[model samples]
Target: MKFDELDGKMRSFETHHDRAVMPEMYVVARIDGRGFTRLTKEKHDFEKPFDERFHDYMLTTVQHLMNCGFNIVYGYTQSDEISLLFHLNENAFSRKERKWNSILAGEASAKFSLLLGDLASFDCRLCEFPNSGLVTDYFRWRNEDAHRNALSAHCYWLLRKQGNSATEATQRINRFNTADKNELLFSNGINYNDLPAWQKRGSGIYWKDEEINGFNPVTQQTVNTIRKKLYINKNLPFSEEYSKLINNIIEISGR
Candidate 1:
């Protein structure tokens, strides 16, 4: 009935179910926007199919998370979701998945809301990979998904512009195979192959080291320095080459 007694009881109840991730495994945190369909419609009139503004917000949030005390090596975003690949040894939040997920989603939601001046929310889940090959496969899977979604989206919007309702567009796209969708876009003068790579393969964020010369005012000399910074690359590929690229990142992070 005292303050200390009540606090201890409730805190234990909260942490009783906390589970820790294995320390040596690759960890991935995937955060997805909740109810984004209606939220995007009501708050921001995001462009049909894809919008740079919405993606900019997602990218900013990803950058923020990468800097938030975690050894996150790579960040990937597609549509309304973002996935963060954490270094193998990262034990932030004591590797507690629930706390990490909750705090990450909360922080992402807050950052996005501040960036957009509207309330946005994200929900997160953790994925553990035993090896780097699985990591490469995971990214490839998502990139392929982006390719499929991008194709479908462009076709759907094209039909909508041509006066088909939402239901009709879905039904029409449902009938078309991948080749047929590409042909549809080609017939309408839009080259699916020529679309922005980010739209087709999602975007990536990683670190790049640049060497620069810094002036020393006191000594009147120039000092060569290596600066490491986060780089957002939107032109990533979705081919086997891309799998190699992701594997390289995983290898570097492992080191």
Candidate 2:
């Protein structure tokens, strides 16, 4: 076979099962740390339940993803997962699902591993939303999930600190409702409501227009200019307000 013919035949096999996201649909890529339980707890000395150092690592990874050659408008990270919201008109890689999944996973894993000084990996999957409302709801879901996970972690770690085994802590947390978990923390003198908002609501990264004053050498005057800068929000709101915040971000991105 000719060289071109042989190459064409192999390329067809590689792309035969390829999929692309539909146009006009909002794309959100969720990248989650693989085996992070053992990675965070056993292999590392990060504080139980929550740690500022670990949180900073996740935030830094998210920031890198936002700037890593994609038209991502917003990023959110909590626990060992990061969610990226792409611009509505993004057509990168011709909207290939596999391309987004593989590159995002590779980028996140590489960035995080470099930060941690260890071999860490992440897996990525994409979420498609047909409308802005659904996009808003999607973030709201993750925000609420952060709350639930935070509560559970605090309760579980409290039990462990009180001399309960891993199994005992898991069993007790499994049986407790939200109110029960809050009370458990309260009885132990740790108020769930008083915890850092970032732990309960996760952190958000988005671009905002900042006014920068630059000296115009030729004109001999300081001129104001607008620049897009990434802003990280550790203190996020909840419920309906969070939905509004998501909506506003989409609007600002020209969706």
Candidate 3:
């Protein structure tokens, strides 16, 4: 067979089942650290539950993704996971799920590994929403998940600190309801409500406009120009309020 004919056959085998997201659907690429429980605990020994250094690493990764050749409008990270919401019409790699899955995960894993000075990996998946309402609901769901995970993690570590084995800690936390977990933390002088907002709601990275004075050689005068920059928002709202915020972003995003 000729080379062109051989290449066509190989390409067909690989792409026969390929699927791309619809251009009109809101595209969210959620990247999660693979085997991160052991990676964070046994290897790095980062501060249990939340570590500011690790938190900053995730933030920087999210910020990088915002500028990495995509029309991403929002970046959210929590508990070793990052969620990137792109403009509804993003056309990168023709919206191929395989491209987004591999490259997004590859970028995240590379950035984190560089920061940690070790091999860290991420796996990516997409969340598709047909409308703004679903987008809001998706974010709200993740935010609530952050709150739940935070509560469980803090309680688990506290038990370990009191000499409970890992298995025992997990079992103990599993037995408690939300109120019981709050009370447990309160009894230990840790108020869940007073915890860092990022721990409960995760962190958000988005674009913002800033004005800078620039010298225009042609005009021989200084002029102010607006530039887009990535900003990290550690204090994200939750529930209905958070949904409203998501809607507002979509409204202004014009899609």
Each prediction's total of clashing residue pairs, residues at least 3 apart in sequence or on different chains, is 0, 0, 0
Q: Each model's RMSD to truth, in Å?
A: 1.5, 0.9, 1.2
lDDT tens readout by residue for model 1, 64-139: 9998878899999999899999988988888988888988999899998999898889999999999888888889
Any idea how many clashes model 1 has? 0
Model 2 per-residue lDDT tens digits across residues 190-234: 998999999999999999899998999999999999999999999
Candidate number of the best TM-score: 2
- Ranked by TM-score, top first: 2, 3, 1
Best by lDDT: 2
Scored against the true structure, residue 122 in model 2 reaches a CA lDDT of 99
Give all TM-scores, in the order shown: 0.95, 0.98, 0.96
The runs of at least 3 residues in candidate 1 whose Cα sits more than 4 Å from the true structure, single-residue gaps closed, are: 1-5, 217-219
Candidate no. 2 TM-score: 0.98
lDDT by residue (tens digit), candidate 3, 1-255: 999999999999999989999879998898999999899999997998899899999998898878778889888999899998898888999999999899899889998999999999999999898888888888888999999999999999999999999999999888999999999999999999999999999998877789999999998999999998887889998888888888877876773
lDDT of 3: 0.90
Better of 1 and 3 by TM-score: 3
